[model samples]
Target: MKYVQLGNSGLIVSKLAFGAMTFGYGNIPSVYKVGQDQSQELVDRALAAGINFFDTADAYADGQSEEMLGRLLGARRKETVIATKAGNRMGPGLVQSGLSRKHLFDACDASLARLNTDYIDLYIVHKTDPFTPLEETLGALNDLVRQGKARYIGYSNWPAWMAAQAVQIQHERRWATFINGQMYYSLVGRDIEHDTVPFMNNCGVGLTVWSPLAGGFLSGKYTRDNLSDPNNRLSGFDFLPLDKEWGFTVLDAVREIAQNHSATPAQVSLAWLLSQSHVCSVLVGSSKPSQLDDNLSAVDLQLTSEETAKLNELTRPVPLYPNWFTTMTLDGRVVEALK
Candidate 1:
């Protein structure tokens, strides 16, 4: 249960961030049917397992998820890091969401009220709003920090260039910058490797990976044999669209390592992410305590270099365009190997 610094900030968060996305609305439209009692049990289990960071979104179950987590962790509020997002519709009104100052502040306050907390550990801009100027959005966020409403800021589901631009704007204006980035990154979704990963590495910003399992694709619970099960979470939601043929290749490799470690395939999948140096935290969300336990145990599963090498070989994507050109053009430009 190791803790890593959040970007360049002083706060040290756990290696796994419990995601509250699954806390509410089981399979309903926008609002899944998750009860409070069940939600509390899951929250208690996560904290008991040494998870210190939790993530939720304003739009999740129409904010019911935040409300539940707030009630669950409100007493020991200072002990954990609570992260939630803005830029999603809070209601039918046009002003209820987005990155504009109106929506940002309103959304933050609404989230705070629901979570039953005064300050948010990490407040993230859920997405980029081309309609709103970056200056306006960040200026409002900086105001939140100044007001002690939020300790740190972050971004999610944003492009590499947009993230870099926000950091630069903050620097020039001397405003608070986003020290962390929360986005979809995993063995199956390596698109960030080319852009987002490099930007975070160079800027000293941290990466909090969401959907690291590609919405349960890497869990090994989904196969041609069980795809039609009505109880399966991924049955209707085939989210984040995976390349099945390619995904199975990674799955086959994961099974081999899981067998070697005497662990489940899901544990091997998460271990693969934890083994990466750039990942500060991987978010895990579940509807059952058993599921959470499986994810928690992944922290202890260590894949040897040989095992990792094999998995990488099976899942690595073919380099595209400019990246290929650069590697080819720069090959052998410098000579020398040493210790």
Candidate 2:
């Protein structure tokens, strides 16, 4: 696995991160039912593959995910860069959720204890909380960094406008700011390109992609002839709001590219993501070790310029509002230079 900086931070991390969301027994059997034995084996395989970055969250499997990951990593925890998130509903109490100071402080301790670590390599706010001020959330994160509870901070699933505001506040306050962002990005889900991509690029926030295969929709397991597979992860968790017909259309192109490169659909999809300059890492989760191995192989598969452009055009997101207007107003020479 190739290594890179976790955003602009001095810290180094693997380009392919192992997502431990599938470590514990989740609500769905396919997701949460993996036992400790299997998790250990998978963890061993990941380490062997040179995947040092492991991502989990407090909300995954009522925190069982952290426990399983901690237990599996055991003595090898020191060799890995563990990233986990907070700000999700962890309890029934009104104070149990959100990015308030109370929850963040308590949540950090809980995550540390669960992960069996003294400090989190990266602590993230899982989602935005309208009720709590960004100041409060960022301040708490800064304190955690200062206290050595979390070494770096970031946010997940946040809009660009709010994220830009957070970046400004952190810089102005001289507090610990964002280092990386973990978001759902795939060939079928390219909406973040309009705003989030530009903002992260300008602000120096790195992106680590989640669900890079659209929950297995781009794994070449689903086709027009076989739209529904009980064995597929999407059958249990179809969280991504992707149109099946559109996904199949995208899959057709991915499949064609895969054949030309002598690779799998999933490899082609992941390789396409790695081609993006703004992407720092891609998180690949799996219930089986073989699936993880397939994803790991993508780092070695290089797509040609023509293939990359074909996928780019096929999956390019439509420009939004002022972005389109801004492009329209650009000088022809400037456009030519960009081309």
Candidate 3:
């Protein structure tokens, strides 16, 4: 697998990171219930395929996800870059969640214990806590780095403005700044491009994309004819919303490209994300090894400039107010002035 530096950080991670959200067996709603044995087999296959980055979260399966991932990696822990998230509700109490100092410290220790590791390669805040001050959350994350509990810090599911503010705060305080931002991004969902991608690119923060397949809608299993597959995750969990009309248009383009490359539509979808220069890694989770293998092949599926442009044109987001106004005002006029 190809390795790249995570944002401005010195740590290098595999472009295709294995997500362990599917590693637990439980009645958790919308979660894939794979047992330890199958999870181990999948992990082994990923490692054998050269994936060195693993992502998990304490909120997944009520923390069982991390435990299963830890057990599976076993002795190969040193060779992997393990990432986990906190700040989600882990229990019934109010104190059980949020990015407050108490919860972060408690959650970090719990994650470390469950993962059987001394330090987390990357510790991310799972979501924004409007109730808690951003300074408190960032300060706690900084302390984790200073204490050697977490090597680097990041945040997930945060608005672009908040993420940019956090980076500025950390710089001002001389604290550990975030090196990455994890968010839902895919061909069907190009919303992040409006702000998050631009902010991250300007601030030197890398992006780790989750739901690159739009939660399985772009997996080729779903089509205009076969819209509802009872066994599909999207049928039950449908997440990271997309405009179905436009989504199908993008899917058509992906299908054409997939046929040309002799690749699965899923691989084509993933390759599209990998083609973005700012994307550091794309997280792929699977209940079976075959699915993992298909995703791994995306790294080798090269899309030509024309094919890439076709997909881009089909799904590109419509320019919103200020952006459209700015483009209208400056784009042509600047060239005229230069002439």
Q: lDDT of all predictions, in order shown?
A: 0.88, 0.91, 0.91
Q: Tell me the spans in candidate 3 whose CA falls farther than 4 Å from its real position.
A: 28-30, 331-339
Residue 42 Cα positional deviation in candidate 2, in Å, after optimal superposition = 0.9
Rank all candidate structures by their lDDT, best first, as comma-separated numbers: 3, 2, 1
Error of 3 at 286 (Å): 0.9
Worst 10 residues of 2 by lDDT: 225-234
lDDT of 3 by residue, 177-296 (tens): 999999999988888888899999999899999988988889988877666766656667875667777788778889989999999999999999999998999999998888999999
Q: Backbone collision count in every prediction?
A: 4, 2, 0
Compose the digit string of candidate 2's lDDT tens values, residues 178-285: 999888899999999999989998988999998898888899987776666677666788878987888788888889989988899999999999988889999998
Question: How high a TM-score does candidate 1 get?
Answer: 0.96
After TM-score superposition, what is the CA distance of residue 191 in candidate 2 from its true location, in Å?
Answer: 0.9
Tell me each candidate's TM-score.
0.96, 0.96, 0.96
Clashes of 1: 4
